[model samples]
Target: MNILYIVGEFPKLSQTFILNQITGLIDAGHHVTVLAKKSESNHKIHEDVSKYHLLDHVIYYDENGRDSKFFKGLTFIKSIFSFGYSQLLHKNHPIHLSWKVLLSSPNLILLYNRLKKEPLLDIDVVHAHFGPNGLLAHRLIQMGLIRGQLFTTFHGYDMLRFIKQKGDDVYTDLFQSKTVLLPISNFWKRKLEGMGANPARTIVHHMGIDVDKFEYHPIKMSQDIKIMSIARFVEKKGLIYGIQAVSKLIKKGYNITYSMIGGGPLEKEFRSMISNEGLEDHIRLLGWKTQEQVIEIMKESHVVLLPSVTSHDGDMEGIPVILMEAMAMGKIVVSTYHSGIPELIEHGVNGFLVEERNVDELVHTLADIFSLEDSISISKQARETVLNQYNIDKLNRRLIDTFERKTH
Candidate 1:
């Protein structure tokens, strides 16, 4: 089968789940051509995947046209506004686009023409990554310009955060598609079902992780307890509360070290809080580590933390792939009972769970893990879950099964 994967960013190679899914399809003998918007960051792909072709970018505006204090402030203010009320601020894309496509119009004709040139001929299906992009692909298919079947994966923000308004029946038509509706957790599956999607097409398909990248090592326990989290340093991740918890633990004379990885919008603010709270030594921000580097960090840490929550703007995480990666490495995971997380972490069994954005609970959970005599045994069980369910081998089988069922 030939598949066209439409995404915002492709081949980031930062241990993202989308990359894992792409690689899995290739290994399963499906020819895939990734059509994506290139990122500003200079990232190199894994050598093994260099031969796989990708169309890096398409239509976009020059955001840096005019730089001034007013421009910068306007951009920041716009970001906040767009999130809280996406539908109001957004002009609806046409339900059916015109034959002439342009950046201003975002036409299906232009896209079909561009896609027709791909070397991966005989594309049996067009599988987009998110909802808005799916709307674009859907428009092409609805206009009778594309013969391939249309499909999409609604990652958290695409289905959960996107604002739909009147006259936007794009997803309504898309939901009726025979294409696969793969959600990483039941949370998304239920959300779509409530929105009146085709129940027959929906499947709780998981994004896989390559466990070979993260290996469990026999390391002697350190005197001070350690906690780690690897993600984009954003408001939704709730990294700030973890810092506050470390501060509270230190006041009680507990020895602990908190290591954070990844970089994002909240970098300076997080650093300032760490110093103002006098937690420079305890709270270390290892910004934007590579995939290989993050795997090494997981192996060294005592426990992995993912204190996720819905931000004030409703931006939240789906079941994060990093949590599975941590568990796969035979490390104890300490995360919250946030959206879709419980589906992955069984409280008191695979790892520990607490309420969202609760500092006191984090402190208590940390103390509980430190007090355990057979913590490694608990870690071993956590490892077993990943091997049985979360590893790429198992998840790949699930994905192939879904694809086969959908295509046949």
Candidate 2:
């Protein structure tokens, strides 16, 4: 089968679940192409899959890659203006918040057109990752160039409030959706169904982790009971609250160390919190490290926490892949029962789940892990869940099955 894959971005440091899916599909002997968002970040996309070598089989396109930086900057400015104009409709414009959301179809049309030619996009199907990104690809198909089926996975943010604030109506224009992969919890899927996705086309496919990458065999085990979380230091991740909880844990002299990976707008604030809380030694903010760094931290740490909460702007985590990665690596996980998190974690069985933004619950969970002996057993259970359910083989098969059926 031929598939054209679209995504917002593919960071070079580490391969996200989309990449894993691409890798798996390509390995299964499917022809594929990737249309990705071009960003100013310095991460490289790993084209190591055998499919990438088979140029006819797999390829990736970055929408902004061909445009000049000056033109891109001007387009960004115009988007901000458009966002402000849309704001006359609402008191607060969540659209105007991030400058990156300014990247739009008009700016990327040429790139998509070029893709239509090279990938011969009329292949069997074109699958996009997020709503807007997928919708952009869908528009290209409507342009009469790419003769193929168009479907997009409504990941998070796009449908969650990010696209809504920009005045993009979710109710209008249906693409030829063969599937809408919602990795989020069932609760999130129910909300999407309420909003207007076809129930028949909707799918609950969790981004599976590569069990080969994370297992019970200790790799980088640190002696101290440590906690690690890899998320953008943003409001939705509950970083601010997580920081407070970690500080509270310190006050109790629990002899714990915490590490926060990934970089974002909240780095300075998180650092400030650590300083004010006098946790310089206990807390480490390892900003934007590579995949290797994350795995190292995950292996060495005793547990990982994903304290996600709905932000003021309605932004929330859509079933973080980081939690799956940690759990896959045989590390105990403590995530909140918010959004679709509970779908992955069953409290007291594999890992523990707490209330969203509950610092007390987070602290208590950590204390519980610290109090247990042969802690590896808990880690073993966490790894078992990932191996059994979140394995890439099963996920890829489900995805391929959907694509083959839908595109045909």
* Clash tally, candidates in order: 0, 2
Q: Runs in model 2 with CA error above 4 Å?
A: 11-15, 44-104, 111-119, 175-184, 218-223, 374-377
Clashes of 2: 2
Q: What's the residue-level lDDT of 251 in candidate 2?
A: 82
Q: Rate the local accuracy (lDDT) of all candidates.
A: 0.70, 0.68
- Give the range of the ten consecutive residues with the poorest summed lDDT in model 1: 56-65
Any runs in candidate 1 off by more than 4 Å, and if so which? 13-15, 44-113, 116-121, 144-146, 164-170, 218-221
* Candidate 2 local lDDT, 1-408, one digit each (tens): 878776655534434677778778888998777655653275533444333653344334443365677765665565446445655245354322223322544444344435535535457877777777666665556444455777667657776785666564543455234445443457756866766677776777777866786655433333466888888878888878778877887788767788988878989988888988789999998777666567777767777887888888887767788888887777777888777778788898778888887788788877776777566666677778888888888888888887777765
